[model samples]
Target: MDTRTRFAVSAALTLGLLAGCGDDAAPAGSAAGDPAPQATGEPWYDEVTPASASGTTGGAGSPCPVPVSFPLADGWTAKAIEPPKGELAELLGEALTKRGGTTARCEVDGRPAGGGFLRVWAADTPTVAPRAALEGFAAGSGETVSGQQFRDLRAGSFDVTEMTWLATNPLAEEEAARNWALAVQSAGQTLVFAVNEGLITERTDVLPAYRLAVRGLAAPG
Candidate 1:
């Protein structure tokens, strides 16, 4: 039980509640000057989100300060997240905020695109490789993770390790769900960008925007 992401298993129950949120219809309001959609043939899903770059985050003026900067899709928003404070909060924070050897730094809400989130998690270890960070992230899942497929993906000029896997939840109507994550490096930290398929959202709903951001990842140039 300690090996799984307890929170993820419980989240699957709400998947149906977010049904239809992943429609292939492209979101409007993308800035005309922003980068265009960069699609990948991998992780093949029926409808790719035609999300355009609304803006970017993680650089100086961005809402959330992270090790890396990535594009934000239209209809999505970004915000910084923090763990709870106080003595009792410290214990809860460990469970709520920290996972897979990383702490959540930025959360890109894709409710307009897919009811889920593209969360960025960062670790203190600057030298940690991408694969190891993703492994920790999967290990942190409360549900049973399997069918993991790992590969090399390019994010801007950087090389990243990407992983796609299936998570099982006994409580959900759809017992098996898909999830994706990628790890990249910055100055003194290892950052993991991931989207979990649960908690009122499905993979299809959020992946378009996720892919857009992943393809747009950069070293805050």
Candidate 2:
């Protein structure tokens, strides 16, 4: 699949590549004692180090008109995505950019770095609460979502509502993958910082980058 198509979330592409598609079993070749899913249903925290590099996005000179600015990890490139013109193109654009009740404004691509994307999605209504916005997003993601967990946390100076879950679609019904998003209110907008990948990589390779962004989340001052 093209990079753009692969980068589109589960709501946009049914391909089992990313954006929450899951697998029922771990990949075939396993070491003697690999970690398995926890009985408590918590997210499997991998042992990778947090990304050690950074650039910024979501400011005046940034590529996207996002509500917040955060670190872009090493090898990830951020891009502002414009809605397509013309009616028919607009329809497809909506599908590619919109999820639940929010629309993706920017994507921090990690494919070149051997990972997925850190997408910035925004809600239409500023009045929506962060938790509600996140719930709507999970429900509308067009995947068989399960093992959802939600919590409140502080990232930079902003209060964040974060959700993690396992999801899959018809194309990847057996390989349900873990995914996450964080919602925050900033600059009169409700924005979601999502770590989305659908590729067949061992251990979602972008989690360190996602964690880095979440750790540095800030309003676009």
Candidate 3:
């Protein structure tokens, strides 16, 4: 597989690992007195997590450093994750770190984690145009439906570009889903955040969450 294809596949698995599928009708989180309902059957990769079961929006534990810290929308649980490693690490180059919305439902590799995924890295382009950076990244993210469509928007004082696409998960064969990404130039680096709604089952609309994350984007003190 080529670079984009590899990136896309890796990302898909990462998502799957975060968003585990299930048949239980129970919501994502359990009530204080209620325990999380047991799944009726094996968790599928394409299970649709209900919006009511959505995650809490906020940082976990301590505050993260600049380029990593950003305010998340409500119904999201955001926190840092280990960086990409080995080949994935080499491919990203110039240092790459990750943060995820653990409660956001974007399932990959059978893992049901969260909806929003964030990556901030050293800029690899001479121009700082967010669209260019977003598109460039998408181009290498394997074969996308009609490639990546982009739009302009504002995230605080920063101008932001959002891109969306339907990406095929080659490893999973029959599975595909809608994916969206936001790119912003901040603190002399490029910040990219993305979310996915699997196509195999009903998809979730996470535009609001994505936009909220954009507004929260900021530089560290």
Candidate 4:
């Protein structure tokens, strides 16, 4: 099988294992305000291994640093890329296409998430507004979504917003829900994007590393 297929299979298996563990809700004290105590040593997750060219390129400008962090899971990987453009749905569609994935725009809680390209476009390009998007996305998923915003993190030549998403996985009920975070910044006409997932079921514990990775991004002029 191809590398992408392998990655997808691994992700599916991991999700399955997490789903099988009943009461996947993160242990108590994992809320946005109650972040886990900082560890003095190395991050919990391992560094990302490099991958071969995937026909993807960085967005037009450099990525600004955002203050976020998360533990990198074993055997998992992460990569930085340019944020999607065009209408929100179009952009999402394009990105997913690169991964052989498909996406649709639908509503979340009477608000739009699936096809709300305009909302995203008007807000700001390459900005990290996961809360806004998740509010709608979660409502659509029928899962309660909650998170906090880390504001004013400056990296490179852009300002960034770092937000975390906490929700129960509707499809993988036992997978401790899914905790994901993203760092977004705008540069020139391009948006810088980075994402980290499967680190911890709790948003607070995983955000620091997510923030760190965002801050570390350097986009070329």
Candidate 5:
């Protein structure tokens, strides 16, 4: 698979991992004192050092377990779809911690002529650091990633790495051009904030909202 496919597949897998969590999830690989999932050889970031990471409350009475949240901008609307299951679940569940993750999708500009959806995936894993997971997914078969560098940035009190990539259609025969996925990862979870350039003509117009979404995500206080 190409890097593009790796990116999308990894995101989907993260979501699937989230859907697999039972109320009684153990810390990834402690069952038999053995590593449950195969290792990808990716290096982990430094441990989460801060005593408190910034986060927002789930409104007054909302019940979603995800610690982070994203905003729905003017042209955006939430998507309602059943979570992944069965063999699909088995496939995506492997690389992630059994503790699972969370996903949210929204249509942009009501999905106008060229508009698409902005999707975010956040997963909590005992074994994988947010940066390592992001790097692992960004690694595609044998292709080289060009023109981008990972940088340290802060989202509220949470320290994160910001990585940008040219989004492409994974299923296309040739890597067809798409928008962009401005992904940020904190110590506890990975968040992907995507934008469809085809749908929204001016990238600048949507950046502020995207930045706000990133800042809004916070681990439990």
Candidate 6:
């Protein structure tokens, strides 16, 4: 199978597990361990951190437009993308294609982890999401749902439902979770979409920041 196919399968499996937790109230993965350190004010992932010695760049911001109407924890920065086509998914696909990756839209789960369909881009060559790309990461990445709420948002002429997930990062669990959120909007035949890595992790310290970011999202008219 191709890399995209593999990602699809992995994403599906991961989402499936997340979907099974309905009203459990205990939060997924809490049993794995105690929460990590709580970030003060805004976490580093909310802002751009310079690259570390391991060569991993820290705190990359999304390429979406600035002053985008989304909730943010104190100190977190949010950017918005003004797509040329006015459709987020299409714009994301075009951006990925420009960077040598192939893109497609697929049905996503919309329950515990904020299930719904979303567009995913895959690349055999190096590519990055608009946010990561602007930050100079050379890796193939895509955005998907990962949290418990489906938020309605408006961007440009699109109406979108956004979801978040606590992404797992073996090395920087807190930082990873603080940076991921999946936002999707339907614009005619296309879905305007955005995903952040800071909000997609299982760290406790990051959950508050993730919640703050979710609260910051504004419905686009």
Top candidate by TM-score: 2
Q: When superposed on Cα atoms, how far off is each prediction in RMSD?
A: 8.8, 8.3, 12.8, 13.1, 13.7, 15.8
lDDT of 5 by residue, 1-221 (tens): 45455556535533433321322232232232231222121111112121122233332132233345544444444432234567876555443322123344222222432223444544344345555544544443123433333444556555555444334444455443323343454444465545433322434444434455555556544
Local accuracy of candidate 2 as per-residue lDDT tens digits, 14-119:
2312221233232222222322222221363534555866678886668767767888888887777677677886787777777899988877777678776678
lDDT, each prediction? 0.66, 0.68, 0.43, 0.30, 0.40, 0.30
Error of 3 at 12 (Å): 11
In candidate 2, position 69 carries an lDDT of 84
The TM-score measured for candidate 4 stands at 0.36
**Evaluation by lDDT, superior candidate among 1 and 4:** 1
Q: What alpha-carbon RMSD in Å does predicted model 2 have with respect to the real structure?
A: 8.3
Candidate 2 CA-lDDT value: 0.68
lDDT of 3 at 99: 26
> Comparing 1 and 6 by lDDT, which wins?
1
Query: How do the residues 1-221 of candidate 1 rate in per-residue lDDT, one tens digit apiece?
Result: 32144445223212211111121222232222223323333343524764688888886557668767888888788877655567875675566667778887767877655556777888756578888888888877666777776656556756777777777765545566678897888776788988866556766668778878887777886
Give one digit per residue, the lDDT tens place, for model 6 in 61-152: 43222222333333332222222344664544344333223332222222233322222222222223332322212123342213332233
lDDT tens per residue, model 4, 1-221: 33344345334322322111122232222333332322222222213222222121132221212222222222223332223345774454343323211122110010011110000111133243534443333333344544432323444344443333444444443433334333333443222232323322233333333433344445532
Cα lDDT for residue 28, model 6?
30
How big is the positional error of residue 84 in model 6, measured in Å on the Cα after superposition?
19
**In candidate 5, how many Å is residue 143 off?**
8.0
Lowest summed-lDDT stretch of 10 residues in model 4? Answer: 110-119
Query: Can you give the TM-score per candidate against the true fold?
Result: 0.74, 0.77, 0.51, 0.36, 0.46, 0.27
Off by over 4 Å in 6: 1-63, 66-68, 79-181, 186-202
Indicate which candidate wins on lDDT: 2
Mind sharing the TM-score for model 5?
0.46
